[model samples]
Target: MGFDWSAAAGTLEVVPALERLELLAEPVASAILQLDDERIGVAEIDPELADTAAFCEQYGSPLELSANCVVVAGKRAGEVRYAACLVLATIRADVNGVVKRQLDVRKASFASMDDAVERTGMAYGGITPFGLPGDWPILVDAEVAAARAVVVGSGLRRGKLIVPGEVLAELANAEVIEGLGR
Candidate 1:
């Protein structure tokens, strides 16, 4: 049978994200207000289950519909570059290859947890592209951008956002790239 979000989400209630800004981190809430996408929704969750695998398992959500946003930092010519890569949970972001090249840095790696949280104003395990700095690039994996709907962090461990993939692809700084996730 096809996935049932209501059943999968268990006892957690999914509601219009804008209606529950209190459940989202400040930055995420602000971003959602700007997005004005009615398709976006939010659900309360256990902060302890913020990680993709754990969240999916605990909520009975399909892993394929989970989107992960990772923060990457690269240094080139004494300048540091940061970007957010959004990919499906079933695969990994090609950080060393695609991300390194995209950032035009000699090396690319996951940003330190402290750095990521500080820069994005989001919890370490709950960073999402929606509230990232305006200057930061948001790399959207082809597969993730093609999904009908996906679950992603709400910029805090206490909640998650459900958004249509096309909405992510259309974000102001989003760049849909092939082979971003592999």
Candidate 2:
């Protein structure tokens, strides 16, 4: 069957695995649903596509057609820690340079998969900026945000959320940035 937001809403059930893991974020889900451009579709897929290339190929969608939101852990000189960063599937965030500079941290690294899962309330490979902590620094690729619509993580490894790109930025309170290299 084709995706229907209303029907999906009526069901309104978090995937069993996500629920059991306690990884679903209600605020993120609700924020995504509240957008005015709410025509986005959500669907689950095979686990193999958790990586960008496989996901694009399997779905017949371009890597440029999707946005990747990542959570990076930064430790500042003063001992403060934070998660940040977002990019399109076609590009990778400059973790050691730009991201570190932005966060004013000497070191920045991708959050460990377990740490990402535990703190973000999202499964590994399914973390999106949608329901992330409001204080986190969210960066977005200009091109991805310019798309009419783009697919993003759905808080579960096996599912994705398709929505207007601009709306996704709004939901994440993200700032558009440049120089995300492929």
Error of 1 at 125 (Å): 0.7
Query: What's the lDDT for candidate 1?
Result: 0.88
Global Cα lDDT for candidate 2? 0.65
Model 1 segments more than 4 A misplaced: 1-12
Candidate 2 structure quality by residue, lDDT tens digits, 115-164: 87877787777787777777887877677667776667778776766656
Residue-pair clashes per prediction, in order, are: 0, 0
Candidates in order have lDDT scores of 0.88, 0.65
Off by over 4 Å in 2: 1-27, 34-37
lDDT of 1 by residue, 41-144 (tens): 88999899999999998887888889999999999999999999999999999999999999999999999999999999999889988888999999999988
| Candidate 2: clashing residue pairs, number | 0
